[model samples]
Target: MTNNLSVVINSDAQQVWTMLREPARIAQWHGWNADDQEAEINEIYFGPNVVEGADHTSLVVDGGDVFTLKPVPTGTEVSVTRAAIDHNSEWAAWDEDITQGWLTFLHQLRFALERHPHGKRRTFFFSVPGTGGSAIENLGLSDVPAPGDPYSLTLPTGEEISGKVWFRSNHQVGLTVHNYAEHGEGLLIVADQPAIADVRPDGGSLAIVSTYDLGAHQLDAIRNYWDKWRAENYPTSDPVH
Candidate 1:
């Protein structure tokens, strides 16, 4: 089955098109990459069958995923269309996940273009068990949000951030982290990672994809805080991750 997602970015089509073709820019906005499995980005866009256009890029993967940019009066209309899935193939099992993954990346493209145009990001990653009962509650988020509502959260580390909710699902929450001053904003994704059972002790990963250079000390401080919080909240039975 095919699936697609679209967003109107507040930038010109040429600018957005440039970001799509550049590997470094793609890393800033998309989740799936060809490497770095520890995080969501894996460099999948650089595949050989890729076709680049004035405002589009068509790639053949899991069938074919076409990325296009249409010029609008305001900016550009960006979309990713996933071709029909071949059920007999190995990619069949990953159909839904790939669709959702593209959705996440498309929104990320809009977020990066609209919010942090020329900013760079430093990503922090960690995982915890999925059996926790009060972890989401303890994070000071009373509930998940739809596409356009305000969401304010206070992390277990006592860092507070407030911004409009980007997207949320039963197993994931994506929110704009708006506390970076002039440096750059952030997209904080808290999601379950059931597919990666081989990595951690059956849990999910927290991705703080931010567009600021919060330095090593500050970054490590937050990472340590999250690790400590995870240790206290999710005592894993296995010694993985």
Candidate 2:
């Protein structure tokens, strides 16, 4: 079935458009800075199978995926509408992965723009096999609040974050990683990586920080900490076949 999601950001359409359309800006809110953003954006948005709106407010990509920007009283309401999934396709799991990936990335976009516009970001990501159930407690989030409720915790790396619970489900935990009054907004996502049938269960955690002017030294520090933490906590996942 089709999947879609939207967020009311606290900025106007023009500003959001700049962030979305500009490759350098997209890196601040979307993927790791190492991503080939311009290439990906062109492939997805400017390719042959795309239709653009007159005001450039919306686009229809191949396979009927729709991306839209609508001005609201507060700011822009950004949205994505993915075409329905075909469960019988060979890439059925890939279809679900894209839908969930968009959900996470769109929220990252909203958090960056609203909290720290024009910021740069660093990402930390790793995955391991699940213990056949949720690892919320193992991750030290035993005190996590109800969805939308405010919460704060210090990671094993000694960094602390405070923000409302963005989402939580059997397979994932999403946090609006507002690190006290010091750092800008960020997103921490814990998810079960999708797998084709007959594969072992695996879970992943990702951290994306909106660092306004922090240099590479700072990013390296956080990255090192996460690497150590993951090694100490998560078990080695199954090797690829």
Candidate 3:
């Protein structure tokens, strides 16, 4: 099966290339902060299995995934052609989950380069077993909006957020929250995971909240509020740190 995912970021090819190759820059969007994040990144991205294109426009990472960069009028188009999954492999059971993860990370990369080019992000993530409901609907965003459309809504938690609609897809919705970061920039991604045979029988819901430049107290407050909100809304869900 040919699975190719791409995103256009508002940055030159060189800048996007830097993000793809540099460890510190990769941390800005690849995954949430963790004690072993740095080591994990080094292993997966800089390990012996990786290969870089002679012209610096492509990268072949572990597991045979290929990333190619092309300069577009607006910026750079970064595309990833995923490697085929082997049923006998350890990660075969999570194939769909991995694809969804790539989608999230690609958008996060775009968000990082365009919105907070030089800033480190603080992230919050959660994955919930579906309750026969849409997670996007729960976020009060059921009415799908076109990309770049402006929106303002008070969340179920009584938090007022306003920004442009980042992007929408069949299984995911992304938003820019102007009030989240210190300089009024943040990214929120909500996704619906369909049930797979022998895996995630009830389906699932996933969300990622990325913010920048927040003080410790402020970050703590935001985390606490969301923690309470998630507990109330997704009592059975397990949050991924």
lDDT of each: 0.64, 0.66, 0.83
Candidate with top lDDT is 3
In Å, residue 164's CA in model 2 sits off its true spot by 4.2
Q: Which candidate's TM-score is highest?
A: 3
Q: Candidate 3: where is the Cα deviation over 4 Å?
A: 1-4, 197-199, 239-241
- Candidate 1 global CA lDDT score: 0.64
Candidate 2 per-residue lDDT, tens place, 21-41, comes to 666777666654544665776
What root-mean-square deviation over C-alphas does model 2 reach? 4.0
Candidates sorted on TM-score, descending: 3, 2, 1
Q: Give residue 107's lDDT in candidate 3 (0 to 100).
A: 90
Per-residue lDDT of 37-130 in model 3, one digit per residue for the tens? 8998898789899999998899998778888999999999998887888999988887877777777788999999998999989888877877
